[model samples]
Target: MSSILRELGALVIDADLLAREVVAPGTPGLAALVEEFGPGVLTPDGELDRPAVASRVFGDEAARRTLEGIVHPRVYEEIQRLEAEAPPGAVVVHDIPLLAESGRADSFDAVVVVDAPLATQVERMVRDRGWSEDDARSRAAAQASREDRLAVATHVVENTGTREDLRRRVEEVWADLHAR
Candidate 1:
């Protein structure tokens, strides 16, 4: 069997090419549920109807259970599938942006957080994405608190500097991880 890391490397290499198949039929029940609850509920492409989701289920306690009912199983199934397919001793580092929101960081072998200063994050969000300050702040706030993220992180990459610096830091960390 290939090493787990090798399997992971394969996945990472092809991740961008992995089409978003959650909306397709014959997927896990959770995917179906997410679609039923609100397709693209977690899309990074901003295809989801945020207001509609908020109105139907995002903000209300009643909707919380409903949301979880659809999302949790899907997440679990995906994890299971990946694990089954992964090579032995593979590190399954899921880049779940909302891991903190879902309170599931304990499941991973390690938690790595990449962070930038609030001012930097806001500036990038606004300048690159055209988000208003309030929108940027709200997006930031909706995730886990910075302190919380830092607290749980086994390793952290400070992203306040230049891209090259961040790249070098990432390379160092990756090398260290692979060396172990």
Candidate 2:
């Protein structure tokens, strides 16, 4: 959806990309993780071992909070920096995976949630990411409920359809945003 928005001329700042950049190798985010959870969170080549970190954090509330504390601020700072570079009158979209959980839904001009049913989400995770159904469900449980996400949505891209349908829906949403 964000890619569609980008194609429609919105300046999309991707949080997922920033999340990875913040933790790359020798950055403070990585150092903090090493300090808090030890170097086992790192790959043999000293990069973040995401699965290892996920295994340790997802089931434990405190550990997840600790991880969030280190990463969120850094990502936000980078987001601010990138957004500041947007040209005047440009449509700036923050493509975030955890907007509702981050307590920042109110921060955006409009929140566009690409929503799928839980079954769809689970199936996608299991199929696309090669995660076990249990791990997928566990990860989903770690985040805010679907209701919480929907409560804050100003626009929703219903993602329970075919690829061409998604493109058409995104185009409609893009048109709606401009129509406003």
Which candidate number has the best lDDT? 2
Q: Candidate 2, residues 1-180: lDDT per residue as tens digits?
A: 999889998889999999999999889999999999998999999999999999999999999999999999999999999988999888888889999998989987788989999999999999999999999999999998999999999988899999889999999888878666
lDDT of 2 at 68: 94
Q: How many residue pairs clash in each candidate?
A: 1, 0
Residue-by-residue lDDT tens digits, candidate 1, 66-155: 755655656666666776897776545565666666688888666667888788889999999887787788667656788888888877
Candidate 2: list runs displaced more than 4 Å: none
Pairs in clash, predicted candidate 1: 4-90
Name the 10 consecutive residues with the lowest summed lDDT in model 1.
10-19
In candidate 2, which residue pairs clash?
none
> Could you report the Cα RMSD, in angstroms, for every candidate shown?
5.9, 0.9
Top candidate when judged by TM-score against the true structure: 2
